[model samples]
Target: MASMLISLSHFCDKHGPRILLVTQAAINGSTGDELLVPTYPTDSYCESCLLHFPKSSINDIRSLKSNIGSQCFVSTQYSSIRYQLLTLIIRRSFSEETMIYDGMPLVFYDDIRGLNLVMGFKLNDENARGNERRYCIIFTIDSTDHTSSMQLLSENWNFITGGFDRMVKYICNSHKQELERQNNVNDEKSNFNLLGKTYLRGNKVKVPRNLAELTHDELLFVRLHKWNSFLLNSCMRSSSE
Candidate 1:
């Protein structure tokens, strides 16, 4: 089981899914709805794997085998209307929309790739709007050893899906925390007073009572200069000692 899992991980590193995003865009002076776009693989290993399959887009690579091929130029637009429609059909057939809404991922046999598997699912984000709101993952598996690979994947389905769920939660929580931090910073900026006691980068600084009044920028410069001088003096004393 462990060896199978490791091989499966390595397989995924090569053929993992690239996100098929849908976002609003302006086209010919009109607003377009759910404009589909492809993204680079989120994993560094998967990105490195791209160096192997140069003629193939993430979607088109299902036609390619498990082995790495020589680098070749690719002119086909993976995000073209036809490919988009094909992906849409694949999603619908795989019940990808249902999976997104119901919070369950679907793994099914590839319609075209024979004996290979396809997994489709979405990550929910409360802050997203329209089609941009759906963080979808759809990938097809191509393995040299299909029998053992299929068995391992089928048996460990629950664990695989749970890991994906946890990953989504971690990402969402991190984003929420960052937004909260930005909000706190803005609130501090709004509440700050400029005319009262001396402040250097939001910290109070003591100045001589007899010293001339200084503008905010001038005061900041003075404080910075004082810090530099103190550091220099400390360094000099340490060197002497």
Candidate 2:
């Protein structure tokens, strides 16, 4: 997978194009190997393409297996139209239609700093017996959403499942960091005893009785309740191990 991702990154660098790729592999089959085969153009442009690729080009790729062997099964799949559609849906749903400027598919949501919601598709292979040519839609909720976006994607199983688990793990780590910062602030507040002290050396100060501090475990609990158990467990495992 790392090599494949690296190859994809290289491909992007050389082509100067950004695309998302999805692959379907047979049980115990190599995802990389299946993607190298030359198959029919299953590239789609929209949700309509996603529904159509299976019926159209998927079979042609599968047929190539006989002549070229499994090497012919390796193919990349991508779709700009589907990405545009999904991006538009997400942007509009999030009430960020204005973010779509200059016909760019990406839109930055100010509420989440460093977060740009992007939608794109890439080339991939469907590992079928004969000619299995298909492309999968790649929907990515990047690390910029301050963790919550990843959580939402993980909980919503309807979204494409690839890479989502890792994304959620990253979000959980970010959440932990934020929680630790808050906890540190609470600790500092609690350390200072300003109760019943109206004036101190010609300076007036006010303070609360106790500051609320949340432990990492407590934050994880909150995340578990709000997100999915599977994601929480994965996060915990990642953090601990």
Candidate 3:
């Protein structure tokens, strides 16, 4: 997944971004047709294509996978498009009107900082025989409205906004050093706190004040209570049975 993401980013470096259209796909042959399809670049400068979607323009190199987890790439465009779980497709013009996703506009806008979102399809293969594996496109439109989402997507960008490979190398080294420092501290703590053997029963426990140094009368009272409890429990059990 990392390799693919890296490959895509590098491809962008060479060939630029590949644009696609996205929309809700029809299922079960209900519509018996595609929910959406791709639009090719035309000689006529599509005022829409000549222009970016809205966040400024299309940022097409899309989503990250769970296996690869966190990813970083140079955020070359203001916004990028990700095709997720079920609905993503290449950009194209539709004969009929399409459903408008209100929040999609923000993806093309530069309103949020450090907002590089990875969007795309996910393949799941949890079923037996493995033949049931399916591809599902995922999506999130209300991210801009979400503070935590915005902040989380904001920080931890492997995306080198400034430089390219050299910048990536520097960041990687810094992270490696920081990780090593943390590991060292953890090792020190573990070594310092080590005990070759431990006897949990050796720990002392005080007797309850109420039960301490009871008189003969009190002892008799406890015995009576114990007998009463046993009898009561027995009676209850018998009744239940």
How many clashes show up per model?
A: 0, 28, 27
Q: Put down candidate 3 lDDT per residue, 145-240, tens digits, no spaces.
A: 455444433332232221223322332344356446656986776666565453233223322111101111223222322332232233223323
The better-scoring model by TM-score among 2 and 3 is 2
lDDT of 2 by residue, 151-170 (tens): 54434433323334343344
Determine which window of 10 residues in candidate 2 has minimal summed lDDT: 1-10
* Cα lDDT computed for each candidate against the true fold: 0.31, 0.29, 0.25
Positional deviation of residue 88's Cα in model 3 after best superposition, in angstroms: 9.3
Candidate 2: stretches off by over 4 Å: 1-87, 92-162, 193-241
Overall local distance difference test of candidate 1: 0.31
- Per-residue C-alpha lDDT of model 1 across residues 67-96, encoded as one tens digit per residue: 112211111113343343335434443443
Instruction: Name the TM-score of candidate 3.
Output: 0.19
- Model 2, position 134, has a per-residue lDDT of 16
Worst 10 residues of 1 by lDDT: 2-11
Better of 1 and 2 by lDDT: 1
> Which candidate has the highest TM-score of all?
1
